[model samples]
Every structure is written in structure tokens, then in C-alpha cells.
Target: MPIDTTPNAAIQRSLRQCLSNAAFMLYQQGHVLETITIPFRGLDGSALRQLREASREWPACQQVLESSEAAVYNEHGRFVLTAMGRELLFDMFGQGAADCA
Candidate 1:
């Protein structure tokens, strides 16, 4: 069967919110991107699929996340952000050096 690739505003909003929340948590906890997980919150199947799709389309998401065999084993993969991902997050979110430090 063909997949439905149509964009859903609500899903986009939810996904963006999820990423933003994750970014904030990373900042607050002072956890480096390598230690942080994208899609940090538990999501329903549909939302998880959406998150995966968003990661593909967004550079920041792509840089920050990667899918691994571990995800399949865990039933929910935890993606660690790369150094570039951390830099991109701070840049996109306007977080200052002090904020991260």
C-alpha cells in the first residue's frame, strides 16, 4: 500500500514541540547532546512515525538524531545528539554560551 505523505499541521506542531521540549530539557539538565535523546518523551505510534519523518526533513533534527538497532530492541530507540546537533540546537533556540555552561 502507498503511504500517506501529506503534511499534518497538528503533527508538525506536536513534533516541533517535542523537539523544543527536549532541547530545553537538555539545556536545563546541562546534558550534552551526545547524552540527550531526541523524541525524549514517549509517543504513540503515529507521533513516533511523524517524529522520524521530521528528523529526515529537518537538518537540525537529522544532525541531532540517528536510528539504530538499539531502538528496535528497546521498542523505543534513544537517539543521541552529535556535537553539531548541540551547536545547531543552541543556534536555533538562541541559547547563549553561558546558558549551556
Candidate 2:
């Protein structure tokens, strides 16, 4: 199914249902998967995290930039924003993650 980026609740629901069913079918086939937030362009977590605490959610949230290089964090509950994300926030709001309350 085609994706509708418009802010329509019905369209969003349909897209979500489609994705959910696909994932469920995969799980039923014994191919379970977990969600992992990743950096844009598959950047290095070390390089990106240094720009900010990119592993803020490292404990509870799974973040994977590359399967070859992974940072194992033993904590959670904090939020992290990638360098690109920080730049976007700065460009959009004149505020980086550090400036946010």
C-alpha cells in the first residue's frame, strides 16, 4: 500500500495496520524483530553520541547505527538526539538539545 503523509487519522491508521500485520506475519514465522532507533546515513554512534548524549535512552531503548559497531549502555530514561537531529532543531528553533528545557 502507498503511504499517505497527510495528517489524516484514517489514512495513518490504515498504514499502521498494514505495517503491524506484516510484522505479525513475520513474527509468526519465527522471525521476531525489535525496534532500534538509528542515526541518519548510518553514522557512527560514537561520533554522533559525542556531539550529544546520544545514548540517553541506551538502556531501555535500542539504538543501532551499524551492526558492526554497537555501544552497550547499562542505563535509561534519558533522551538523546543525534547530531543531525540537533542541527535540525537548531535550524528550526535556534536551539540545540542543550538549550532545550
What's the residue-level lDDT of 27 in candidate 2? 43
Stretches > 4 Å off in candidate 1: 1-7, 34-78, 81-101
Residue 94's lDDT in candidate 2? 48
Query: Runs in model 2 with CA error above 4 Å?
Result: 1-7, 35-101
Candidate lDDT (C-alpha), each: 0.43, 0.33
TM-score top scorer: 1
Looking at candidate 2, what is the lDDT of residue 75? 35
Residue-by-residue lDDT tens digits, candidate 2, 36-76: 12222222445334423533433222222111122222134
Top of the candidates by lDDT: 1
Q: What is the C-alpha RMSD of each candidate to the true structure, in Å?
A: 12.1, 14.9
Residue 82 displacement (Å), model 2 = 15
